[model samples]
Target: MPIFLEAKLLVWLSPLHRESWLWACPELEEKPYAIVPSPIDPSQFYDMKLPREGVICVTSLFEFKGRKNVLQWARDHPGQEITCAGGNPLPNEPLPPNCRDVGQISPWQVNETYNKHKAFLHLPATPQPFDRTVSEAYLAGCDIIGNKLIGALSYDWFKSREEVAEHCGNSSKLFWEKIEEVLND
Candidate 1:
């Protein structure tokens, strides 16, 4: 049996995933499906008084998450500090001097890290379903930079990492609106 037939509603984190599903099972197009990006509750994040600084990357220390790319980016930008918050470094993989590994952090801690960082970096080896961290970082007012395969949303179309901060202010509200549209449908 097709899984779509068994579900009341199908929610996809990205349009790419939804399109792929419909392409694979064209019959499922009749089913109710929504392309809703991941959500982040603003209340969970702290608003910082100090100016944000440095570049921050949050992902598991796995190779697929593009840890090497982030390390390389850190090395390339010698003057800027880069902080990584996620699972510990892989065995025998030492972080670059410009990059500081914070290991794994709680959601709240991630919010704080976003509050402090000037930019967020993510370079996945494969396309991401929907990176919740992108939304969280936007809500925390950090500039976004990295893989174009992050999601189906407009943020993925951001012109540049440096310009991403300008779009951050309204993302949280838009995120909720999309969720409401999905739920109401």
Candidate 2:
């Protein structure tokens, strides 16, 4: 913890993450910090514009990822089919009948998965510094349905597809620019 405190600047993935950190380490309020989100290549995901419907969750089935919430959502929406694409379920954790686990798929398959669904659901039990899947799902033309824990949703870009893509395209440059500024100081 002391080693981490020695840093000149702390770059956070989102405002929510920054706030969370500040809450935990109030003393760090005196330190320099920046909010720079992770980038998502727009090319890797595209809106197929198919007749999309239902919901899909692209998250690992772990407790921290909100495996319990996922199950609850499936149970709540008995009529709605919730397709999940991720593996590593905690032992003895079975998904509800409406929730179908497609297991873990390659990154290439994620775009296709989003295309098939109208909405993307992400409800992590704990706060995620940033969940790139939310941005990727949005880029693929899926409506994002997530809780406040998803750090990406706290940013303005998450509201519009164009803004999301633009941010993704510029994120790398922005990150480096921040780094340069920190080094120059």
Candidate 3:
């Protein structure tokens, strides 16, 4: 906190984080700060026009990431295809029969995964500072189903996962407009 105060500038990746930081230290209100989200190369992630089938959850296989919730959801929806990407499942944490665990996918592969999957789930136990996966999924045209704390400015407040998924899909122009707005600010 002391070092932060001494710093000339603070670059926040998302407004949610910026707001949390300001709330934590009201004294920092006068400090210089900017919310610039991590960049995503459009060339690397294009709409492949692939069939958006099945559900996918991308995140480290940690308990707090709501891996258990994903597993339970998979169990409840046996007919739906579910894929879990990121690190391997924890010891003794066997995945359900309906779920396929693709541990630790590369960024390029993640783009492809997002393109292929129709829905993306991110049910983290705690609030995320910023979930880049959500943006990636949205960019790739996947339906987003996650908690409100995802920190992506594009998503509207949604109650149910289905409600969120219904609003999936993104416009590159809109995304670029947001980037320009933040950068120009």
**Which runs in model 2 stand beyond 4 Å of their true positions?**
none
Clashing pairs in 2: none
Q: At residue 103, what lDDT does model 3 achieve? A: 76
RMSD of each: 5.0, 1.3, 6.0
What TM-score does each of the candidates earn? Answer: 0.71, 0.95, 0.74
Candidate 3 residue runs with Cα over 4 Å from true position: 89-91, 153-185
Q: On residues 115-175, what C-alpha lDDT tens digit does candidate 1 reach at each position?
A: 8899888876656667777766766677778766576234454444333333443455665
Worst ten-residue run, lDDT, model 1?
A: 161-170
Candidate 2 contains a number of clashing pairs equal to 0
Pairwise TM-score winner, candidates 1 and 2: 2
CA lDDT scores, all candidates in order: 0.68, 0.85, 0.69
Q: Which of 2 and 3 is ahead in lDDT?
A: 2
Model 1 residue 46 distance off true place after TM-score fit, in angstroms: 5.5
Ranking by lDDT: 2, 3, 1
Which 10-residue span in candidate 3 carries the lowest summed lDDT? Answer: 161-170
RMSD after Cα superposition, model 2: 1.3
